[model samples]
Target: MKSPLAGLSKFDFFGVLLLRIGVGAVLAFHGYPILTGGGSVWTDVGKGAAIASLPPSFFEYAGLASGILQFIGGILLIIGMFTRGTALLLSIVVGFAIANLIAAGSFQLGFLAHLQMILALLGLVFIGPGRLSLDRKGI
Candidate 1:
């Protein structure tokens, strides 16, 4: 027998909206500190995204770019504007974060957070913002 909520497919858009807002808010919250903290803070945070043998100087720029993208993309996703593109870029950012977390030898809440977020972001990339979004007419 089908569950009562089996009909909830009609609410798929709401699911997308929830995903966007939730992920966007998180990105914005985390990005804000990096942006406001300037180069010094960026250098510290960029270590997460660092590739092999890259210097601290590279991290400064990487962090700066990541911060900008996270804040802007987060805002865009919240409003359902440019949802797919934002999700794609944010996926890369999350990828780096996940890699860093793994390399650091930890299995904390952050691991779960990034894991779920990446999955959602990738799904959003394919599923889009849906009918209730700015990309569609019902905004």
Candidate 2:
């Protein structure tokens, strides 16, 4: 069968490039600080996880894992290397973040940012890296 996205054109590819870069930058911005911020950041993250009813160990390990995933995934996404895999992983992370925030009664405007990021990442997952990316051997 033909691919559903076979109709996507060069313009769509450009749009995908913009989306990938924007989402990648945002992920890096949020992740880099946590990764480099030392123990206190992990403590805070663990506390947030605790508030969301996760296990106590989640903060120490999962927090670090999350940061690493976001940091590395963001870089890969921006470079268009393994774009689908990166977007998919980041989408899962963002989805979990949204779920945790909502579960913790944080239904405020800030959570909207996570929701938007999830949507954008999901879009990238479906659209692929586009022609401007390294995935396509572009510059």
Candidate 3:
């Protein structure tokens, strides 16, 4: 006999899709002001200064790349195109940010934001794009 879970419908896919898009949208929205408006002063001037002081270029590149990657990944994720790949990429970016933040001895609010992104990434990885997603055609 089939497992009881076999009765699940494709409607569950929409749940996943909504989660991915909604979370991605929130993340993107949060970043938008920081990137385009005066908010960057707080983020860039405050954080960027210390980040720029890192020894190697990799750390600096990684720091700069995180915002760019996050913007791109958040857009892709919201659109549901290459959802898994984008989520995975976001996870990597957030993971690196978390590591750097910890290493820098600042674990208060930064850690919480990183953790939120990680949870969202994990949700996308497990639930996938769902039925409302671009990837649904393949399923």
Candidate 4:
């Protein structure tokens, strides 16, 4: 069967671009403090993991890994380079953030924000970066 997206138009491209930039900006902002702040962020992550009864090593590695992924993935998303892969990775990070929030009993705006980020990233993964992206050899 033919792909449903075969008829994608310029408007679809613009929409995807908007979503990509918005999601990327949010991820980058969140990741920035963690990247520059040092191990304190990981310590908090470890504390949360401990409270959640997760393995200690998870905080050690996953914390660092998530930070790097978010920062780099956000940049890639903004540039529209490797858009699908970047969105997929960032979606995973957002999923983890939601899980962490739930485990910490943080049923607040932060959780909602991460949930939205996850949805947006997943949308990008499915819809692609659009014709205006580097992925499409556009400026």
The RMSD of every model to the true structure, in order and in angstroms, is: 2.0, 5.5, 4.8, 5.4
Number of the candidate with higher TM-score, 3 or 4: 4
Backbone clash pairs for candidate 2 read none
After superposition, the stretches of candidate 1 with alpha carbons farther than 4 Å from their true spots are: 137-139
Give TM per candidate. Answer: 0.89, 0.81, 0.67, 0.79
| lDDT (tens digit, per residue) of candidate 1 on 1-139 | 9999999998888887888899899998888887888988888778778875987799998889888988888998898998899999999998998999899987899999999989989999999987777887553
Candidate 4 residues lying further than 4 Å off, grouped into runs, are 1-10, 46-58, 137-139
**Residue range 23-135, candidate 3, lDDT tens digits:** 78876776565445443333552353345556554444444555666666788888788888888887876676677677778979879977887988977877777777677
Which ten residues in a row are the worst by lDDT in model 2?
A: 43-52
Clashing pairs in 4: none
Candidate with the greatest lDDT versus the true structure = 1
Error of 2 at 9 (Å): 6.4
Candidate 4 has what TM-score? Answer: 0.79
Q: Which ranges in model 2 have alpha carbons more than 4 Å from their true place? A: 1-10, 47-55, 137-139
Candidate achieving the largest TM-score: 1
**What C-alpha lDDT values do all the predictions have?**
0.88, 0.82, 0.69, 0.79
Error of 3 at 78 (Å): 1.0
lDDT of 1 at 127: 90
Off by over 4 Å in 3: 1-10, 33-64
lDDT of 2 at 11: 67
